[model samples]
Target chain A: MVNKENKFNDIVTDNGKRIRRICSYYSPNHEDRKDMYQDILVNIWKSLDSFRGDASINTWIYRIAVNTSLGFTGKAFKQMQMIVDVDTENLSLLFDEGTKEKLEQEAQLNQLQIELNQMSVIDKSLMSLMLEGLSMREIADVIGITEPNVKVKIHRIKEQLKSKLSGGKHE
Target chain B: MNNSKISQDTNGMGSFIDKLKREDNNLQKIFKILKITYIVLLIIYIPIFYFEIEKGGLFQVVKVVFIALGFSTFLFVFAYAQKKIKKISYAEPTLILLKKTEKRYRPFHLLDLASIPPILFLAIGLGLSEKTFLATKEFFSSDLNLSTYLVEARQFLFSGEHWFKMLAKTVNEFPMIIVFMVTGMLIFIFVISFVAGYLLWVSKYKPIRDNALELIKEIEN
Candidate 1:
């Protein structure tokens, strides 16, 4: 028999970063994030026995992560309802800051994080998945919405983000 | 190995899940204890009821029916709550999952109201059956004519008797004291139930409902 603990270890080892990143979206506090991580671990263990593999494991993990993060009620919930700061310092690498200095790039990224934090819960969830470089199909599968619905929502969200950030001119 | 990172952070994952398993077992044990308590009550009740049935009359049968109704109603509620808790699947799509979670955490369940009548009936049946508290027998007794009750109440309350005098008279009247005592107890119980229910809704269910609704709105839109 495959040891359940070893299997759980494998799952967490593979998905820990993703789960941690998702937890960070909902809880900026490190202790709370750990708590969230532990919660997701428990939930995954709860869900593991039922996995029929109808969807890919990645999609399943995403579902749990998003569901757990949204449903999460902890000391962190009221303490940190929004994404305060993520590893956005590295997110600066994703954008060509062009001639902007490092601090300016960091500032711009902070502005982006602020805008992200302002998005509705669902919208922020979608954005988080999108930022993870999941395709529309993958995002839809993970979110349990139609691919077309995901497309439309992502379109609206991107438009809202662009409008908010550019017009927001978060100096 | 990348596994080392997870081990560093979640090294106790196995032990933690074990603790959770123990806690879960404890919860299940509590549920079992509750089920056993109910069964034991029914078992004890069977003999008491059988003895009461030997002294059998209409009130005895009425007591049996009302007690059965109370127990049956509670059983249905218990089964339903357990089934609903079991049915919640975290793996469902976000929309469906939120809807289920929303239902689960609704601050008030209309189905809960179904038990009130049964409970009231059970209380009445018990009061009449327990064979003490003469006031309960009097209340449930056949001599409780409506006009007589109204006339007596009117004479007692609105008669030219002063309020303090009325209270003194009430205290002097043993039956009235018992009636007021029963009524006061019931009212106190009702008030306590209402406050406890309110606290449970506010502290536990309302926040979950609000969170679910927020997500549901976002998703549905």
Candidate 2:
């Protein structure tokens, strides 16, 4: 039991930030993101006993996280549509004396997250997996879709996001 | 070299793990409620089934049989879901677990279809049973003078009396009218029950089936 606990802790410590980022992309509010994060953790813990050595630990975690997020969105469709009130306290925690470069990067990420929240649930899942640097084949495996389908979807989602991001500018 | 990156990662991990541990209580509470609700519903069905059988007849028996079958199907599906829920280890692959969950629920769609048979049997059976009871009562009625009337009509018709032939024809037509009325009533009952069953199925089970199918399709893809 202790060994199992240690293993779980190690996995969480290693990938927790990536999981949180993925959760943030799907969830619009601080509370929902936290809830989704907890859900993903519980799912991972529940699934830990059956983890064969077939897939890399990272691949396995991503699959659980993505699937859990999709399920969460499906269950809370109305909540997903509700406008998110930015939690200023949590936002402030990310800054350590707020350098200009750091602020600019944060702004860009926030803009991307806003646009991501507007996309369909499937598109969001695909985009987040792409952003996480998963290979097309890995994305296809995690999503249970063909590799070609993942490639097409990624291309289209990128174009869609680009248009949405650029459409807001005067130029 | 990148102390800020390490700190940020640590902070994110610490906060998330803390939140997850705290929410474990809520998850347990929800699971408990679900289990209790399922058990309560199953208990309620027992007395209901008993009462249905206590109202005994051929039609009642048939209705009870079908109801039993429907309930058995529900029990089987519920048990399967419970078992799957139990087997969900923290180590299972997400895709595999999701697929199993989908399969566990797929059988419940058949509950809507299972309901139709009992309704149809009950409706037709009731109609037939009612007609038999009424026919038996009429046959045993002390006021029924049908036999004497039939004999007199036959004799008069054989004596070449044209008016008595009409009486004999009218006597024969009485049974046809009863048959027609019984047939019409049976059709009415069947139609009403079928429509009721269909509406119930649509209202209750259609959404569940659609949701299950959506999840299963996602997994299959």
Candidate 3:
């Protein structure tokens, strides 16, 4: 039991923010996000005993996180729309000082966020994972799709994003 | 590495996990009950086969078939559920997990159908055992050896007088079979309606399942 609790701690400490971020895209309401967060933790805890150390722990937690978020539409879970909050903390972390350049890039990111919200849930989820810096291969593994398929779908999505964000210009 | 620190940092996640487990949905409880039924039926049939095998005629056949059905049914459910849980690791790939999630919330589970034949076999087995026992009361009354019981059981089975008596006994108790069958049918209907009504409407998992399918389609396409 101590081992189990220790493992749970390691998992929550390591991946709690990642899990919460993914859940935020699904649940707009704060209470529902907490509920979604709890559900993911419960799943991770239940699945803790099954961890055999084959894959990286993050990837395992990630799959569970994504799987739980995708199915987080129970009666208790309000069908709250996805609300993408700009990561101001990360933005500050990225740009130490508030400069003109930071503001410009942040505006572009805002536009990108709007485009993302216009996307289908699947597309948005893929985009979110991509922004989370998962490689195409990792994304495919997490999603149970082929590497080539991930590349194609992500490429198509990028093409659409560039065309729309660039005022219909590709380059 | 400090578990106590994690509990403090995460606001007592240990208790939260316990809370979630306690508050799990009723559908989960139902599945757990069904799993227990597997062990219960397997344990039940062992003693049943032991007690009736000495009858050595139709009684033996009925008991054997019913017990075999029970054993195989339990084995199939256990192996199948374990395979599903073991094969699809949340760490592996999302598509396998997605398909699994879709099936988990599937309005109509195919696994439930596996119980039908065993149940029907049991009902028929009970009826046949009843007929055999009614005909060969004299066989059970004596503590005869197997060969002697088998010879007498065969003789009584072929005798026209016992056949008539058996038919009369069946007619006299036919209403019990009707009641059993009616109860079974009612249970089946109740389960079906509950799945469609509760899981579909209340839990609203169908849309979630449909969304998973949509994602699968996007990825595969």
lDDT of 3 at B116: 65
Worst 10 residues of 2 chain B by lDDT: B1-10
Which DockQ values do the candidates obtain, in the order shown?
Answer: 0.39, 0.16, 0.40
- Cα deviation at A113, candidate 2, in Å, is 4.8
Regions of model 3 farther than 4 Å from truth: A25-28, A73-111, A166-171, B1-4, B11-14, B20-57, B64-68, B75-79, B82-88, B103-110, B129-205
The chain A TM-scores for the candidates, taken one by one, are 0.79, 0.73, 0.76
Question: Which candidate comes out best when scored by lDDT?
Answer: 1
Second chain only: TM-score per model?
A: 0.70, 0.32, 0.53
Candidate 3 residue-wise lDDT, B1-221, digit = tens:
66456555454556564454464434356667877887697688778777778667766776688758756765677668766654544454677877777788777667767766766666546656564445345434546677754443444444554445446666344323333233444465766877676755445676777777877776677
Question: Residue by residue across A1-171, what tens digits does model 3's lDDT show?
Answer: 667777787778878888878777776677777877887887787677688877677678778877776666533223335455455233322222553244467676676556666666677667667766787888887777778988898888877876766668433
RMSD of 2: 13.6
Error of 2 at B159 (Å): 51
- Stronger candidate by TM-score (1 vs 2): 1
**Clash pairs for candidate 1:** none
Q: Grade the docking of candidate 3.
A: acceptable
Stretches of candidate 1 above 4 Å error? A1-10, A24-28, A49-54, A73-104, A163-171, B1-14, B129-188
Cα lDDT listed for each candidate: 0.69, 0.59, 0.65
